[model samples]
Target: MAFFPSLNLVARRLGMYRSGGKGAWLFLPTSSLARSRPGRLRPFHAAFSTSAGAQHSEEENIDHESSLGRAGISAFKRAVLARHSTKAFDAKREIADETLAAILALTLRCPTSFNVQPYTVTIVQSEDMKQKLAACMLGPNSARVLQAPVTAVFAADLDPVQLVPRVQSLERRKRGLPEAYLATLPFSVAFLAGKGHLAHAFKDLFTTAMSPLQPMPSVSTLEAWSYKNTAIAASWYMLSCSVHGLDTCPMEGFDGRRIMHELHIPASRYAIPLVVSTGFAMPLPSSSPERNEEAKKSPRFPPEAVVFKDQYGHAYKGISQL
Candidate 1:
């Protein structure tokens, strides 16, 4: 079976478990999928499975290579510091096809709960589609949507339970997990799904109604989990774009229902978290005082204010302490 190198690394890093000389599975509750292009949904199960039974120790593993090099890390930090919710873009500039591919590949490497990978990116590349998306966004954001070379709608799958079983099994087998370990997954999933009424209903229908013998997994707050996981992927996408000399603006001020309709996403199956506009950035105005202020860097809280050590209230000290 052909596995994505990133997926393999993620599977390893995220606790790929094995027992009884079986398969190795990356244990995550969420199922993430990759879409090479718009309107195409491919199952990641095959791509995530492997025939090799070789077990890897966390320290000695060579498959776990960093996608971001020293230069990439520097670029990432600069991007994080420099990135803004850009409202203006160089509409004349277009992202190269290879660059976009590289960005998506990196984006899929983001971790998810249970390794379920439960989201899809709908790429809007054409001007007509961008205009349609703009109609659903706020007046101010509409221009940015249209001006960017691409607008990616990050949507979460409401019914990812359907895809979990195959992925779980394949990933587990690849990791050489035993049947005893695999048996516990059903109950774990059911317990998670049980947390939320909507999630419980959707997941229970499959685990119980479809197969009364199995345990169900539902989340207490399904939408929250979905949004959070998808956002991680979105962040990765934006940073990856930054590393490729591109820009992005993550927008939430849009009509979700209208976006669903425009994008042909069925309301029953998917939920839109936000739309991200991607392209080259236009230079901030230098002469205008108001525009200059807009160009000023935003302040951030110090590390001591946000970083905790052992306990919640304990502030983390400098690296010298380590």
Candidate 2:
């Protein structure tokens, strides 16, 4: 899936040029990343807020037990740089189940809006199923779909408000929210969900009506929220694939309506966001010796163009200048 909803936004904000086309993203080989380069900007010295009890709660500290360990930082750097869209995959090369599980397990730790993880991933690997899915795609992706070892369809739960009780309870305890407000959370969620009462409830419930109580938590459109959260999780999964020496191609151009119907996905509950094709890439043809070598690097905006200071237009001086 395209991480950002708009390619034009990415181009305008970061000054990046998409490699193959609008949907295509190029991944570099891990060996190509320089060991000394910092992965990203360090805007603040503290990792989190130091205000009293401003600390991240145990539930929020998902990375505390990260298995990425000593090599985690470098591994992530290589993965981010190396992950690119692989237009072709070696159909013969299959990913081990264990490897896929590890990637999925780590990536699932990514945060969702209000911790309500409302995404569903369906993995299609059988040759018969792959062929069926390929038929659903419109462009060159048809060939790419069949060639890949596995295709994962990511969907979002349409009724994410159902998860509110579980999420709010955990978050309330972790974040030190008042226990008195817990009883009324479900009603507030319902009020916000109802279109007729939404505007009044959104304004009154969080403000004047609840003035004696604390502020009501934010509850926006579930469809939009689910899409954003699912995309983030999918991105993390793709990066994890790169870290494990796997390649992935995220495709939003597929016929999602066909997929949902053909696959017997519950249309009422889930909404398909995108499909991802993942596996090892095929070896370069002997006729094109330089293609493999050239794959290591893709066009990217320079650091100075993308990074900013306190303001949007103010470009940050890169470490090279500092």
Using Cα atoms with residue i matched to residue i, what is each candidate's TM-score against the true structure? 0.69, 0.66
TM-score, model 1 to reference: 0.69
| Model 1: how far residue 54 lies from native, Å | 11
lDDT of each residue in 1-322, candidate 1, tens digit only: 1323354454334333223334433233233222122223212121222221223343356656666688867766777766666768999999889989999999999987656677899999998899899999987789999899999999987765665687668767776554433443443434453345864565444334322322223334567667877899999998888777788889999998999999999888788998999998887667755366434456657777788899887889783211
lDDT of each: 0.67, 0.66
Show model 1 residue runs off by greater than 4 Å.
Answer: 1-72, 172-176, 194-219, 288-296, 319-322
Model 2 lDDT-worst window of ten: 41-50
Count residue pairs with overlapping backbones in model 1.
Answer: 35
lDDT per residue (tens digit) for residues 1-322 in model 2: 2333553453333222233454322222123223313332111111111221233344576676668676977777777877888878998889999999998898789877445677888888898888899999979888888999888899988776787788667867776653423433443344334233465444343334323332333445656657888999899889989989999999988888889887888887888888999999777777765366445456667667778899886888854421
